[model samples]
Target: MYPDELERYHRQLLVIGREAQEKIRRSSVLVVGVGGLGSIASLHLAAAGIGRLVLIDNGKVELSNLQRQILYTVDDIGKPKVYSAAHRLSELNPGTSIHPIYADATPELLREVISGVDVVVDGLDNWETRIIVDKICYELGKPYVHAGIHGFYGQLYIAWPGKTPCLRCVFPRPPRRGNGDVIPVFSTTPGILGLLEANEALKIISGVGKPLLNKILVYDGKTGLFDYVEIRDADCRVCEE
Candidate 1:
């Protein structure tokens, strides 16, 4: 590590050690969606010094996003999310390389994007995109950190495809939507989950601790409760080939 790089990550170095830190510096991560979840996950990953951070999003920053999307400022409103996030992440950690793709997620695009990446962090809001990402990661044999947030509550887990139950195995299908068809989420909800996603990614990259593999972690900020559930799929369509 360079002298400044070493100094920048000094605090975390003691816990992860120089060898693991080196692995972090050599690893690349793909963060999908630069929304509330993506914003926080990418920020922490960049600060932790992941070698390459690829950000994918096709939306523009909105005034409403300022509530939880900490990566953007008022000036960033109406600008592409990937571009704004890249600028902020670059300023956060010069040692980490930032790659911003201003495009929507698709099967073909995902195949190309997942190439040469070490881990995929799920910052996507909807199940439509996330399921596609999970399938792509499974096909490519990549590890993925999956997380979602809603109404002061959030859930996350690490899925290793063939090794553990994939998202579809756990979900089977998307959960029933609310009557209003609106997700009531607080800003802090995604902030907590996104940071957890970043932490899980770092652990997987550095090989420092056991990844969440088959365990689902749920957080309820309103009640200040955390729950853990073990998950497995005996007849998983995606992983049971």
Candidate 2:
């Protein structure tokens, strides 16, 4: 590590040690959305000295996004989300390279981006896109850190191909699309889940802690409770194939 890098990540090095820190510095992560969840997760990943980050999101910043998307400000309202996100994250950690893809997560696009990363993080809002990402990651054998938020509730799990149940194994089918394409959400919900997703990614890359595998962790902000649902391998064709 260079002198400036050592100083920038000094506190983190103390926690994970120099070897783990180096591992983190060499790791690349693909974040599949730059909204509420992606905003926070990618922020911490960059701040922690991740070597590279590929961010994909076709949406542009909006006035409504200020409620939870912390990466952008009023000035970024009309800009493409990935561009604004890349600008903010680059400012946070200039050493971490940011590749912002201002496009949709089509299968071809997902394949192109997922091929070069060490791990994949799901920050998508809808199930249709999430399922596509899960299948691609499983097919590519990448560690996928998954999370979802609705209202005051959220859930998280890490889907390790061949070793654990993929997202389809747990859901079987996508939940019905919410009313009018807008689901009520509390800002803190995605904030919490996103950070947890980042934490799992860090642990996976640094080899410092256990990941949430083979089980879904559900969080309820209303009651301040967290519950675990053990997931068994299902007859899903995605991973089974």
Worst lDDT 10-window in candidate 2: 232-241
Can you write out model 1's per-residue Cα lDDT over 1-241, one digit (the tens) per residue?
A: 7788778888988888899999999999999998989999999999998999999899999998899999999999999999999999999888899999999888888889897799999989889988889888888888889998888989997767667767887887796556766577798999999999999999999999988777899999989899998775534564565
Q: How many backbone clashes are present in model 2? A: 0
Candidate 1 regions with alpha-carbon error over 4 angstroms: 180-182, 232-241
- TM-score versus the correct structure, for each prediction: 0.96, 0.96
TM-score of 1: 0.96
For model 2, the stretches where C-alpha displacement exceeds 4 angstroms are 234-241
Give the Å error, residue 137, model 2. 0.8
- Residues 107-132, candidate 2, lDDT per residue (tens digit)? 99999899899999988998899888
Estimate the Cα RMSD of every predicted model relative to the unseen true structure: 1.5, 1.5
Counting clashing residue pairs in each candidate, in order, gives 0, 0
